[model samples]
Target: MSRIKKLLMVVVALLLLAVGGLYLYKDAAVRSGVIASGDQVLGADSTTLDSASLDLFGGGLALRGLKLKNPEGYQQPHFFQLGGIDVDVSLGSLLARRIVVPSIALDGVELLVESVIDLDGPRLNLLTIRDQLRSSRVKNAEENSASSGQRFVIESLTVSDLKVMGLMTIPGGGSWPIDLDVPTFEIRDIGKKQKGVLLAEVVGIILVAMIDKAIDMIESDGSDKLKIAGDIRRGLKFFNRGLKESGLDPKLGKKLLDDAIQKGLGDLLKKKKKDR
Candidate 1:
């Protein structure tokens, strides 16, 4: 072969090897990003994932064994755990200021809500995490603005096979468990109004929505779980106050609680009338 042709062949081989290396390392890099983003929002070193796979050319990502630990003092293994997550990204928008995710599907999600009384006072894991996330939102927003970090736009997000469990610590250290199976729900056009939003904001929105649904489920259970329902109502009021303090609109949260209470009252009045 000619010298120039040999040199050209060597260059191509080197380029191919470099691309191959990038492909091999891409998954780890994406995994680290996910962990970092989650930790930032939660303000704890509790975000973990068993594995991540990223399609270099296709912009598809699959994450397995994603779990978020409960804050300190909680007995449950994890506050939130997911069997898997699949995300479809817009490859072209990756280079732009706004990263666009066309769809995200989360499967086999389990949320553990625990209520306990300690030296500090009564506390709920969900409320604790909500407070942390709310505080982080303001801080994250400032940091993103200062650093010109890329924002995200999620066109659709869906959660399936969600199981919510409640653990209430009773007298003498025993705990009662309440298991609920939640129907699948979807949120569309996240960050559409402002074009894009910080990752923390997106997580905060989803968490709050899920908590709201869980509260509704607890209230509507007409079983002998009225105490649990009362605790949830009080927690909802506290959460609404936090929302107001954080400069967020609390109308939706308050309205939901109000409607639930009204419904319960109306049902009770009807029951009494029928009994008479």
Candidate 2:
């Protein structure tokens, strides 16, 4: 019994050590990936993935203090930063020919637009990263199609708990800035070939929602507003149907998506102006 107890203790110790090693290794990998990626975004000098509170599970990972430095033109040295992301990677999809980014949940992010360049330029623009990700998905799909039978599929992607600033300019360059404080933003069936078209619909839906709010704020004329809303809804319905055909579970997808939006945008919208 004494020998058996000692053996059990050894086994438990080994297991704990192994788990610790794996978690540390994963943390190192993520740090390396961030440093390499940040080199491109932040040029030289200070940019780092501070790993004080990082954890890696079998199916998911959590990061903290993910900071990005801006180039010479940027107003602040560290122009943008994210507090954390708790995300689950789709390993099966990754093994296949596609970049299957299933979900990304961002928390406490800061978006600072520099006054140096046109707000529309790549550096200062808030949505540039999202646009680049979409473009890369298409380009990668085309490239990978030549190699394997596996098709890239982003079945669902959701982002929630965002504190946004420096959003894109509203139509016709209006003075009333259209900043977004999204508690949630999401996309489903992102791997489909018609992702661009679907994204256009999603954008339209958001535009419609914003326009309704804007009309209320600015006291705009009501003549064609109803017609515009109908058109936007129609576009969303058609695109949403396409998502269903993309081999994704629409019910689960939409639920997660809506949750993200509600947490991200809803919270942002509800905050008092001075508080934001």
Candidate 3:
């Protein structure tokens, strides 16, 4: 009986060591994957993580300090910096072939736009990144069998302390300075089982939500703002359908908005000429 008890003790110690090693390896993989995904999605080489720790036993993950630099040829030092992501994971779902993160809180989101003279001329900052991801994702989806596809789900997400700043030149002329503060934002049903969500789809959501708020800061006439909003809604409906095939891509919603703004400016210029 004593020998048997000693054997059991040894087994338990070995098991603990194994679990400890596995957890440490997982932490490293998480950091590496975070940087790799960011680089691929943004088309930039500069991506790094400050820290990532996951308490699997506690069913939670904490990630902090991520920097996403601009794509090649852009002069901006970095596009966005993410402070952290705190997630409450559904631990049991990991073994079931689906990653189900129930709640996620993101903090310290920032976007910086800088004036850079690209030889290729001007380009949309964030929208360009979305276009790259959409093109590749659609191509891969076509290549793969739908039945074998994987899923990533976030039941609910909350983002706080978002700050966007800097200026970009419009089509007609002149540059517009942007300074925005998004204190609290929430999204539910991301990557739902019944109706899955894609990157472009989420981008559309971000675009619409951000624009809806930012438009108010433009200091335009009330009637003018309303007219712009009407144009934007119609444009989003059109572009979203095109990009997503059946539904709206909301990610490409910004494209439609840019076009609308350009047309409105052109029309204004024409009216001015007539008045002259």
Candidate 4:
């Protein structure tokens, strides 16, 4: 072979190696970032991801086996778990200050909502997570206003095949489980008005949305489990407060609480009191 041809071959080999190395680094970086950001935002005992892959040319990212452990004192193993997530990102925007994600889809999500009724009243796992996210958001806003962390603008996000399981721990150490299948839900234009939002904030947005939906489902149902909704509503005040602290619209949260109070909780509580 000619010397120039040999040199060309060597250059091609080096380029391939460089590309491979870059892919590996990007994969590891994405995995680490997801776990760290999730733990910080969720205040989980531990956050884990099985695998994360970035399609460099396609600007697509896939994540699998993501799990967020419950906070200390919760009986459930995980507060949240998902089978997989697929995200479509704008390649051009990756180089810009705010990464633009066109769509995100999460599948096989399992959320454990536990209410422990003890001497200290009822402690709900979902409420606890909400409060933790609120605190994290406040701390982030205070500390990282000028920091160079990656921010995102997600145009649309959807969750499918969601299972919301409720567990109640009674005073005698007995427990009851209620299973509910939540219909798929979607949110759009996240971080658009704000221009960009931190990753933790994105998580907070999703969690708050899910929590609101769960509460609605619990309240609307007329089964014996409807009683749980009353206990859950007692904590809705914190939910309202969390929405305000997390930068969500306070007026909307207030309206939700007011409507819930007007619609059912008052009547439900009165019935319980009369029955006892």
The whole-model lDDT of each prediction reads: 0.71, 0.44, 0.57, 0.71
Span of 10 residues, lowest total lDDT, candidate 1: 167-176
- What is candidate 4's lDDT per residue for 54-139, written digit by digit as tens? 88889899999998888777678887889999999856777688888999998888888776433333456777777777787787
10 residues in a row with least lDDT, candidate 3: 234-243
Which segments of model 3 are wrong by more than 4 Å?
1-14, 44-46, 115-117, 140-150, 194-276
Clashes of each: 0, 9, 4, 0
State residue 103's C-alpha deviation in candidate 2, in Å.
2.8
| Candidates ranked by TM-score | 1, 4, 3, 2
Model 2: pairs clashing at backbone N, Cα or C within 3 Å: 182-264, 182-265, 183-263, 183-264, 183-265, 184-260, 184-261, 184-264, 184-265
**Can you list the residue pairs that collide in candidate 3?**
203-251, 204-250, 204-251, 240-249
lDDT assessment of candidate 1 = 0.71
- Assess the local accuracy of residue 32 in candidate 2 as a C-alpha lDDT between 0 and 100: 72
lDDT of 4: 0.71
Q: List candidate 1 stretches off by more than 4 Å.
A: 1-18, 169-176, 222-224, 227-232, 235-276
Clashing pairs in 4: none
Candidate 2 contains a number of clashing pairs equal to 9
Give the candidate order by descending lDDT: 1, 4, 3, 2
What TM-score does model 3 achieve against the real structure?
A: 0.64
Question: How many Å off is the CA of 77 in candidate 3?
Answer: 2.2
